[model samples]
Target: MQPLACRSCGNTVLVAKSSLAHTSVQWADSSRCVEFALAGSLTERAVVSGCTALRASIEDAVRAGRIEVPAE
Candidate 1:
């Protein structure tokens, strides 16, 4: 189990690997409802670093002309 901050209420919540694969994210403080699921291939550290890596990939694809962003 690991203590992860709730994305909703920012409370420190202990989550077991089993729970990450099953139930929805329930905030200890009950602020927001967040739906969650753990990818089988993701490690805890990979999860922590996910957004940064995802953003970098998106940006790189755009810069490389692989992804086209339509004008707003």
Candidate 2:
């Protein structure tokens, strides 16, 4: 997993890309994510789709070759 920080909110998460369509994220602390924090509770955060900021950051990292995916 590669450590990636969200460009918008700066929360760092461990990311692993298995394929272009598959991504796994491990958050050190879900509460540390500003977007998740705004939801006010862990349950709320769980219901939330995900952090768009972090999604964008991961995409950028993949495009920039910072995160490598294995062959299909």
Candidate 3:
């Protein structure tokens, strides 16, 4: 497991590959409430960075008119 800094609280939290697939994000504690499961070699930093980058890329694409923004 690897420690990842939370974007909202800046707290270093562990994010396992198993949790990414099965865990549910909680807003109360801002952390995972499950145990880690063995899987592919992915560090917490890598997962967080990938998630952040993906979100940014999607946002950028939407802003640049490369993607459509859905109306609420």
Candidate 4:
């Protein structure tokens, strides 16, 4: 896993990308996510999908060579 910070909220999370279609994120404290804490109705969805801002951050990190993906 690699470390990445969300561009929108500045929350740091661990990210791992096995392929273009697969990504895994590990957060030390999910409750600390600003977006997640503000997601009222979407709380359940947030638990499953995680913060969209973080997702985009992971993608950007991958593109910027900050994260590595295994070759298939």
Best by TM-score: 2
Model 2 TM-score (2 dp): 0.90
- Tens digit of per-residue lDDT, candidate 3, span 1-72: 333444333544443233212322222332331212122334542344233433344445445654443443
> Least accurate stretch of 10 residues (summed lDDT) in model 4?
40-49
Give the Å shift of residue 47 in candidate 3.
9.2
Query: RMSD per prediction, one decimal?
Result: 15.6, 1.1, 13.6, 2.6
Model 4 vs. true fold: TM: 0.79
lDDT of 3 at 12: 44
Global fold similarity of model 3 (TM-score)? 0.31
Instruction: Put the candidates in TM-score order, highest first.
Output: 2, 4, 3, 1
| lDDT of every predicted structure (CA atoms) | 0.36, 0.88, 0.36, 0.79
TM-score to native of every candidate shown:
0.30, 0.90, 0.31, 0.79
Give the clash count for model 1.
Answer: 0
Clashing residue pairs, backbone N/CA/C < 3 A, model 4? none
Estimate the lDDT of model 3.
0.36
Candidate 2 lDDT tens digits, 1-72: 989988887778899998999999999977777778899977788898888889989999999999998889
In model 3, which range of ten residues has the least summed lDDT?
Answer: 30-39
